[model samples]
Target: MRSEHDPGAFLDRDGVINVDIGYPHRPEDFRFIEGAPEAIRQLNRHGYKVIVVTNQSGVARGLFDEAAVEHFHNHMCAELARHDAFIDAIYMCPYHPDGQVERYRADHPDRKPGPGMILRAQKDYHIDLSRSFMIGDKESDMKAAQAAGVPGYLFKGGNLVNLIELILKQIGRPLER
Candidate 1:
């Protein structure tokens, strides 16, 4: 199928894909949420665009830099690839209104609950927002999906792949496997 017609799975990074251990800027601190890679691989196998949208305010807080986040993502992606899963893209908000970093301190639209990142992805990837879905572990994540006119599912901390399966079923698109 053409990518332009493919729906997207907009995922939150911290709690959804990895354990939310606060400011995970280093690969050493990174830990995958149970079944995250398998869930992503299921999406990939079904022709869904698996994209990650995260709010990384740690950068603005001076806990870490953007390069650190990128490095972590690289490591995570490599691990996902080993499982035959791939993330189509990653969009993060490094800005925070009351941040410590002068350059990154600002209320940017890409921040969660703002919808800027998802909107940008919609435009860039030719995604159908009405058909797309967002998975997050926070209210802000759901709000962002609402703002972007996409359906949102909240994950209350557990096995990610199982939750994804339930989400798909609830959304009337149950996974075959």
Candidate 2:
């Protein structure tokens, strides 16, 4: 039941789009990777749905709150809007098994290495996992993508635009201007 318009690019927030400076929930601390905005804009131009799938254990660890995370997301979206790029949606896991917060102490399916967030996105947005891919910096990200049946690419930290271009080429879909 795959639709022709269901292709998507699932991106990990920290370490992919922004610098992983450890639980960055403040707009002041958010730093966009070089070319990250352009990469997303290219995806937009190509009619691909750009979704952010992230793990924000900071909430569980008591470093931040869910509201703060949402605020940061809003800031991120606004920043991307400046470059005419947009994220279709954002999914995050605020739970961790060893969380300091009792409410968020349990393991959640939405956490990385689990497929809940991806599955939820597929259901909500009608994404085609076969036609989609993920970019992340951790093995847990790969595991999550695998669980969701989506191809995952590892980013060893660099210019996002270049990495995206290389990924597209490897997938036989060279980015075109």
Candidate 3:
């Protein structure tokens, strides 16, 4: 049974929100995909809680630390704020079974294809999963959304605002102020 809680727009960070440049942790490397900010702003105006779910295995691989990831996210947020767009929350998985870091060496449920992050977000935000959807660039992200019982959309790269508009139309969700 679905609750009256608001629907959420779950987004993948890399490839979807920003250009995926391998293990991007530096602020200078952070670049938003075309129309990503406006896409997020559209979601905001449509009454969807924009949430970012990403896998930052770079931390586990020793390429960067969690602090670096946080700093990168902060930079993204700051840039998005300039367009009057904001993400409600962000969940990242730093664990990988083949990680070089001992503490992060594990196949964590929060990792994509596991759905732990989305499930946790659902609980924390009281989101109605039935009405929620995820946009990602990988099949693992689709699997995670399926596992969490939410619809998923695959982004193959292009203008994100166009994708968001199509998704809204497909879902029959009217744009609101």
Candidate 4:
């Protein structure tokens, strides 16, 4: 079915796909969630354009540089590629409310809960919000999805298989497995 609305879903990077260890900018620091690749592969197989919107306050805090973040993404994409899943686009907000760097400081509209990233994806990809859903581990993901008019799924602590099963059911397609 072609959805004239909500053409794709936006995802969070850290806690959603990888283990959130403050700010993971190194390839060695990257750890994929048990079923993240498969889950994303499922989304791709189902024809969902998986996009990632992330908040990298570490850049503002001087914990890491933008190049490190970009490199991190490149490594991440390579890792996911092994599973035949790739994110459509990745939007990151490196600024923080209080940052060491002048440019990195201050609130930015692209931050989660702000809807900037989601809206940009919508405008760029022509997504239908009501038809797409975001799966994330933070409340900010919920707020962002809500603000962008897309459904949100909070990833509470649980088994990976169960989580995917739940998401499928919530989206109205029970996993055949």
Candidate 5:
């Protein structure tokens, strides 16, 4: 049951967190974007639950398996923890309409522009959607947030920390520290 009443920061994994070099399922290839860790840490201090919602179509395309995705998430979490930033939870959709893998060949609602993943995260984290927001590099991310009743911000590169700070300021949420 959803019990906690924390606000969440839904972030896209690819271009938002790390450099999107195609379907990156390996830890060695996961290079964090500039100031990404600090941006998350800032949110942490401001009482926001950091959540990653990504669409991993590579799994359905036969480029990788769910195990690889899990391993990558683990590595990402460990790396973020090292910087005093952490993701409260991660939600990934591996299904695509034209997937090569038969098991994941259907168009899933958890996919971006559908709001399923964000809605699930809201339930799991008991996030206050009214106070939550999403940051992404794609228009689909914005649509997902809108569908979930959360505001969305389009990040067009540069330092993520700066963008995060600006968001916090615009939202008028005072920082704890």
Candidate 6:
């Protein structure tokens, strides 16, 4: 693994940036967690792109389609911009083996724990995963980061502040007051 001084780190979406509302598909349900926007802003200030990797199994459940998910993401971006934070990209995997439709059936590589989305981002944006960090709220998130060769932070249920301190320590950079 590379040192934390690197700039091109990545992050996950669902529970990292916004509270996971269980396959959130509605714009009204996208709640930004406390300190999340600030944390993202901090990373952005340090030259990190702040990409969002999410696994939307809702697509498989046929609750909401990809278009709806994109709409939700767009709204999220707009809200984040209000806090002077913006995501570099929002990559999602809407496929699930137990989902609906002929096409949605089966495991997808882009799904969390598979690292497909992160890999694609690395290839498309020349990201350095070895030096990057990922913040997530689930074991899948950690697994995905591991598969992508990046360190992961399991954003505990509500330990947003703890995560901030951890990142600051890992980066060996003091947080701005």
Q: Please give the lDDT score for candidate 6.
A: 0.79
Judged by TM-score relative to the true structure, which candidate is superior, 2 or 3? 3
lDDT of 6 by residue, 38-67 (tens): 887877776675788888888888898999
lDDT of each: 0.88, 0.89, 0.93, 0.82, 0.93, 0.79
| Span of 10 residues, lowest total lDDT, candidate 4 | 168-177
- Residue-by-residue lDDT tens digits, candidate 1, 1-177: 433566789999999998988788889988999999999998887667788999999999999899999999999999999999999999989999999999998989999999999999888888776668999999999999999999899999878899778766766452233
Predicted candidate 3 versus true structure: per-residue lDDT over 65-168, tens digit per residue: 99999999999999999999999999999999999999999999999999999999989998878778999999999999999998999999999999899989
Question: Which scores greater on TM-score, model 3 or model 4?
Answer: 3
Spell out the clash pairs found in candidate 6. Answer: none
Residue 18 lDDT in candidate 6: 84
Write one digit per residue (lDDT tens) for candidate 4, span 1-177. Answer: 655553576889888899898889999999998888888887776666688999999999999899999999999999999988888899899989899988899899988889899899888887776667787898999999889888888887554446766766677542222
lDDT of candidate model 5 versus the reference: 0.93
Name the candidate that leads on TM-score.
3
lDDT of 1 at 144: 96
| Candidate 4 colliding pairs, count | 4
| C-alpha lDDT (0 to 100) for residue 119 of candidate 4 | 91
Clashes (candidate 1): 0
lDDT (Cα, tens digit) per residue for candidate 2, span 74-176? 9999999999999999999999999999999988999999989988998899886777899999999999999999999998977889888886777645234
Error of 3 at 33 (Å): 0.3
Q: Which pairs clash inside model 1? A: none
Better of 2 and 3 by lDDT: 3
lDDT measured at residue 100 in model 5 versus the true structure, 0 to 100: 99
- Native-referenced Cα lDDT, model 4: 0.82
- Predicted structure 3, TM vs. truth: 0.96
